[model samples]
Target: MKNNWQLYVLILPAVIYFIVFNYFPLYGIQIAFKDYKAASGIAGSAWVGLKHFENFFNAYYFKRLLSNTLLLNVFNLLWSFPIPLILAIFLNQIKSPKRKRFIQTSIYVPYFISTVVLAGMLYIFLSPTSGIFNIMRTSLGMKAVDYMSEAAAFRTIYIISGVWQTAGWGTILYMASLAGVDTSLYEAAEIDGASIWQKIRYIDLPSLVSVAMMVFILDCGKLLSSNTDKALVMQTAGNIPTSDIIGVYVYNVGLGSGQFSYTAAIGLFVNLINFILIMSVNKLSKKVTDVGLF
Candidate 1:
């Protein structure tokens, strides 16, 4: 420990930053269990012993919130997560290096676009009045529809746009792992008269099991969350029923309404679920794969 002072010095700032910004605020977790009041502040707030959590659990909109959050998360996990793996495989198979780079670079640009801008773009394209989508619809002799305002289209747009924005960035790890596959394996498969599908299924796919398992397990931790920034920007009274997930709910009841104790309780519920899922998934990954991320 004494000999590693230089390395410790290099990491000291990050360590302190987490302590200051993350761990220190944990003291306010007590607010969730208290009938917090501005006059008394967090420390002096009267202890209420799970009242907020109880209220939230029994709230009229509880089912809606839970369903919406879970659906979005599951949709993302199933569709968005796997697209990157497919993309990486496709990119790896490209014979032309210049064309491959151009395609990869093009896909990656969407990930760098800010969430706010992405939402705005969706609005602009999906708006019924002047959006390109409606213009094309009307030109085709169909009624101009407000896609963003339709509850049914909310999840579709949200999930598809999320995939569009993130799938490329997500390819990085899979591509790296794919690059590490043994060239000898391919040569042997070639000699054996293996088809492309056979090579991918038996070789490349097996090589990705560890990485895929880890990514799947980690992604499960966010099953109760949604992209609050994008959701908030896209949310409208028309789409509120479908768009209101835990993150947006927390923002509304917590900061928007200033119900600190109630919001804290909701947040605590979210984090607790995430922690439990992470632990459970890690244990499952250990049983199913050679490498577990614990």
Candidate 2:
């Protein structure tokens, strides 16, 4: 008991954080089942049961909102999920430590740029007139197109910019995991006359599986979640259909339109789904690889 005291002390801060940031806010979820009025506050709010939930389920925007959120998540899963693995593998193959550090530093710079600044830069670069992209199009005798206003381009821009900003930062964890892989495995593979590709395929990839699965599970849990600020900053009326993800939709309902109860209900539902996804993925991971967050 005396020896375990330090471990409890180490966990005290996280326990406090969850109490303050997570458990306390659970009381507010009741607002979803009430006709909440800011003047009356949460305690005095009139209970309406599942009225708000029903409203959201039957709302005209339900299908579009759900479709947009799921599609964006799918796109992220398909495209963004594997990038760090590939980057980490390629970066690990570089023999020069100095050159590797330089490349990593350069790649990581984009992640530190504020979302507002990054979105502004994207807008300027993709603008129809006086933008470099359009200028190049015109130079090539093609018509200059306004990419920011185009629905088809919204997902492309969001995914590509997201990859540019986060891929390097993501690689850091995978690279660390790769570094911890036993060098003896590689030596054994080489002694067995395994080619470099075979060494990577049989040895390096297996070592990466646990880290990769953990990351994938985390990503899946956030499938319907996004940063409202980034989405709003990048959104335009013309591209709203493509860019209006769950976070932005919630922001619009609660803060923008004052549909507080409805937004609460929707947000609660989204969080529940996320929770289920995390649990399911964790269980599956345990079954498949004998590794899980639990």
Candidate 3:
């Protein structure tokens, strides 16, 4: 310990951060089982074990919220997971460093945009009256449609926008994995008269297996969660049928309506489900592919 004192000192901030922000907040999780009065505080709150969970289970919007949250994430995972892999593969094949760097930078720029700003951009670009899309449709002799308000289009828009924003940034890990590939392997493939597609299939994809599995396992853990702020901002009266997810519900009824205990219960329930899902996925992945986060 004395030999690595500087190393430990460097890590102290991260340790303290987790302790203060992550571990300390766990103390308040008991509120999920309590009535959680503001005057009573967390420890003083009246215990009402499972009451909030039961109420939420019986709520009319329960099924819709669960389905919406699950479907949105499932669709997002399906769409967003592969684009980055493909981009990384294609980027790896780019031999010119300058061209590759420029493309990589261009693609990564969108990920830096804030969720609220992206949502506002969506609103502006999809505005039924003055939006460019509507204008283009009108020019092409088509009816203008309010995409943001269309419940049928909600998931598609969400998934597409999320992919656009994140796919490039997501390539970082895969690109790193690819960068570590032995140059000799490519040389050997070339000597064997292997084509680019064949080389990618035989070399690149296989090398990415472990990393991909870890990424998939992590993504599965978020199956029941969504970005609340983005969804909340994008939500509209017409799209509530599809856009009303558990996070938004928790935000509204928990903070807005002052039902802290109720929302905490919902949050706990979602966390438990996510935990079960991630564990199940990790176990199955380890069993089948011999690669997992564990």
**Pairs with steric clashes in candidate 1:** none
- lDDT per residue, candidate 3, 1-294, as tens digits? 999999999999999999999999999999999999999889899999999999999999999999999999999999988899999999999999999999999999999999999999999999999999999999999999999999999999898999999999999999999999999999999999999999999999999999999999999999999988889999999999999999999999987999999999999999999999999999999999999998
Give candidate 2 misplaced runs (Cα > 4 Å).
Answer: 4-7
How accurate locally is residue 254 in candidate 1, as Cα lDDT from 0 to 100?
83
lDDT of 1 by residue, 121-179 (tens): 99999989999989999999999998888888899999999999999999999989988
Q: Scored by CA lDDT, what does every candidate get?
A: 0.91, 0.89, 0.96
Task: Name the best candidate (by TM-score).
Answer: 3
Off by over 4 Å in 3: none
In order of appearance, the predictions have TM-scores of 0.94, 0.95, 0.99
Comparing 2 with 3 on TM-score, the higher-scoring candidate is: 3
TM-score, candidate 1, is 0.94
**RMSD, candidate 1, Å:** 1.6
- Flag the better candidate by lDDT, 1 or 3: 3
Per-residue lDDT of 1-294 in model 2, one digit per residue for the tens?
Answer: 697999999999999999999999999999999999999999899999999888888988888888988888889777789998999988987889999999999989999999999999998999899899999999999999999988888888888899999999999889999899888988888789998788779877888998999999999898888766887898998999888887898887789899898899999999999999999999999999998888
| Top lDDT prediction, candidate number | 3
